[model samples]
Target: MSGPAMFSRYEFMIAWRYLRARRSEGGVSVMTWISLIGIALGVMALIATLAVRAGFRAEFVDTVLGANAHSTVYMVPQRIENDLTDEVYVVAGRIQDYDGMAQKVADLPGVTRAAAVVRGQVMASAHDKSNVAEVYGIGKADLEAMPRIVDPATLRGDVAQFGPGIAIGAGIARELSVSVGDKIRLIAPEGARTAFGTTPRVNSYEIGFIFNSGRYDVDRTRIYMPLDEAQSYFNREGVADEIEVFVDDPEQVADWTLPLLRTVGEGAQVWTWRDASSSFLAALDMEDDVMFVILSVLVLIASMNITSGLVMLVKNKGRDIGILRTMGLTEGAVLRVFFLCGAFTGVLGTIIGVILGVMLALNVESIMAGLNALTDGGAWQPEVRGIYRLPAELRAWDIFRAVGLSLTLSFIVTIFPARRAARMNPVEALRYE
Candidate 1:
């Protein structure tokens, strides 16, 4: 322990000596441990939060796309030559050969399925309750082709063999107080234009199934019926308003969207899931960014603890620092020693935090489920809103960003204290001889 060569030749040795020494021997202070734990906690929180946000967004998008087509080729009337009349007219440009158009889109790469869809705004009334909903008149094959948002296993009755039946989302069912086998009346806005006035189309159909789509608006506003039945009721038999397309991966649906739109030719408007849900996706992205920034501030606060710990260490070990300087230890070496001490804390904490965070994020669903079970589901039931279970999608980039921010801020905050230690006067430090 009295070997001067190890202490003088290696700055790291001296740094370790200063940091690892017992309290009686003036080393390893309590503040250092607290600062380390703080950094770990901060990084852990950031990683888990980011993972949860990413997971929830992915799940929500999947759920939404399940209930909606990835892309839709709809008809929009070509502008009349110069519009000579002051006409506030609504045009229903039906897409002829809708099935053929859907097949064209399906033929394109990345496209999985396509279907002709007839959409209408309607009022659904049942059990003395009424709610405005979007009624989808989907072909039997198209309806079969559509992915299920509500697990098919959960349906009370047969959905595949639907016979003039209307499927309702959980929210709609709740609002109308209706369920499977119940009848709901739909009032369509489009009808015969008589000399006296426009007639509203009305029809009633038995509920085939109740779908829990896990989407706030879709659950509340989506209703489904057979294409033939819907067309007959709406007076548009053998014609679909739009052709909807589905892709293998909805996230990268752009690869299929443009070409499909082109396939349908000029004046044909194509709508992708991204186009329809842009606002919702954009808002989610903004919230995620804001959360990242907010959590970074917490890391910065934890980094300050690194500064505090280093400062306290420098103060307590002033004499040792001066004695080391009196030996062959240069100011730069002294600077490095303190720097390593703080840097070590940051690195170690970051490692542990990342590991802990990743583990927690990966198992968030099971962990939440376990907690709910322990508390008899009461703990989480009330909080369940669109998504009933917690989801966590661990992304390496998110973890790297969190750790990078923590370590960078931690290292930067250590500089001042390290500089102070390096500048300590040996004369004053060892004065009371």
Candidate 2:
């Protein structure tokens, strides 16, 4: 029976009997079911939490890219002149350069649009009302391409009128009590001086449109005007404060940014939206790492349960082990039998967990929709401090890592208990039984 011999009918019977008995009423205790449930719940929680975080990241990134370009090129100290034309026409020429550079940048791989932008802090006044806001000067065509300024359904007038018109945010519109066709006076920081010291040089313009992009910060503080009008009003010539570049592939921002910087040379600085919001990105990275460690502890706890269950199985089957050894089964064969049993538990648990995880991740949106309905849809309301809904992104890497760790932990858990079973003494066990 030792060499090239099939397993005896009795050996097969023994394995089958143990397997069937384990599956029956006496196989696992009440505690085992509790452990399995805990594992399932833990897996579900991790999947849901990660998905929501991922969703928020995706949404915010889109908002930022919509408002700002994928990358920005601006001068350090942001000078508007280069030793020319009373520093006035120099600024104007710089503003005009936006159109040319935008064309050039658009020709680069992945760049969709390039627009010159003039941004400045200005006081906007209408009648007896006044508010401080950031004025963004952009070409009418470019403004149409900008998401923050292109919500046609919410607009009071067309953005393409190309007159001395501006688009204000919905929040700004509310605060100023202003609407399309209303006139607002813009006063720049640099004002002309009269005999009575400094007189505020202001230009009145018609509000051509209003847009709301669901972002409170932008909607409350931003105003858009044509680039030429903005430069003239600001008394800047042949120069712009910054050049905003939109890309076809936002993921290629770093790639586009470096080359553009080389082209612009040391006169300018290149920045991505990621750089604009470093604090938030850092927080996201830290949150993701902390979640990974915490969820892994859950898997560890599950592995511990597997370890304990296998140990109990080993203890219960000691007499069987002894009998098999006395019946000419080698120590290696004895070890293999118990090892197979322990491995089976881990493999079975992992398979079940993976199937469950995939289902939950894939259907997370539908599940949230149902939950919202159950709560009378109140869950869709805005949150003062957090995103309203959860987002789950199931990357292949996450699945591979989870499965690999669970299986490895299960195998590790079984080793000590399986070894203990293999080293049982046949004589003592037979005498006791």
Tens-digit lDDT track for model 1 on 1-433? Answer: 5433432447676677666758574434677777789889889999999999999898878777877888878888644443677555666688878778878878887778888888888999987899999988886666766566446764556776466577888888889888888999899888766898879977788988888766667778898888877777777877888988887888887777568767998768877889877997899899999999999998898888888888878887888888988986778778888998899889988988898899889899888888988999865562254656668999889988998899899889999999999999988888874
lDDT of each residue in 1-433, candidate 2, tens digit only: 4342344454445544554445443644433554455555556556555665676677667667777778988876543554656463232224346667767767877778888888888888887888888988887778788775586665667776546578887778888898888988888767665687766678888888888755667777888888878777766656677888887778667888777877666666888887887798789879988997898799778777766766777677778888888988877666666665556656666767777877787787788789889999676643342333555677767767777777777678777877887788888778879
Q: TM-scores across all candidates?
A: 0.84, 0.77
Q: lDDT of model 2 at residue 416?
A: 80
Model 2: lDDT of residue 197: 70
The lDDT values for all models are 0.81, 0.71
Please tell me which predicted candidate would have the highest lDDT against the true structure. 1
Among all windows of ten consecutive residues in candidate 1, which has the lowest summed lDDT? Answer: 1-10
On the 0 to 100 scale, the lDDT of residue 384 in model 2 is 44
lDDT of 1: 0.81
